[model samples]
Target: MISQKAKYALRAMFALAEATDDTPLRIADIAEAKAIPRKFLEQILLELKRQGLIVSRRGKMGGYQLLRSADDITFGEVLRVVDGPLAPLPCLSKTAYHRCEDCQDEASCHIRRVFANVAEATRDVLDRTSIAEAIASGQTEAMLDAQ
Candidate 1:
């Protein structure tokens, strides 16, 4: 399951991507526009900035913006940043793989095999979908409108 933090991060990224200008967006504005809690969003934005997904400006115009184009940022990357590795199980994780303690032989572990396939399918979709494509696909618009 996607954590609430990751969900908020995606919403904030969508709001930023949909902005008409390159100017940074104030935290309050993003929180309000996306209907995310301001305090929670502050923490989410900080984590995203630390991951190099976003950059911040200091001063009167100080705010946050994507470090790269929205098209360059994939849903996989965002989810990984906010939710840790995407793998549903430790044995199947690419970034943080660890053999399951109960598994005597990973090569023939039925549980591992099933979940590995599941993880790969999920990754396939998430990695191929970018923030820009997500917005252009109307999902984001529908979500915002529904709120």
Candidate 2:
């Protein structure tokens, strides 16, 4: 399951994506619009900014905006940035792989085999689904259905 922080980050990204105009969105506005706590949102935004998913501007007309086109930012990227690896088990993680202590042989590990498929399928959906695809009306359903 994705963390609440990851969910909030996605919501915040969606809100930013919907803002088509050049003006950046304020932290308070995004927090209120998405029903995320102001304090928690601050931390989430900071993490996103650090990860280069978003950039901030200072001054009166400044706030937050996507660092690149929404189409280029996949849900998998955001989830990984905010919630770490998406693997269901440590052994399944490509970016942070570590052998499970109880597992003697990876080739014959039944549990790892099952979860490896799960992790791959999950990555397929998330890496293909971008913020642009998610925010469009009817696109989300169509994408999922096609998948």
Please, what are the lDDT tens digits per residue for candidate 1 over residues 98-129? Answer: 97888899899888889889999999999999
Highest lDDT: give the candidate number: 1
Candidate 1 deviation (Cα RMSD) = 2.1
Whole-model Cα lDDT of every candidate shown, in order: 0.91, 0.90
> Model 2: what TM-score?
0.92
- TM-score for each predicted model, relative to the true structure: 0.94, 0.92
Best by TM-score: 1
Candidate 2 regions with alpha-carbon error over 4 angstroms: 138-147
Q: What is candidate 1's TM-score against the reference?
A: 0.94
RMSD of each: 2.1, 3.4
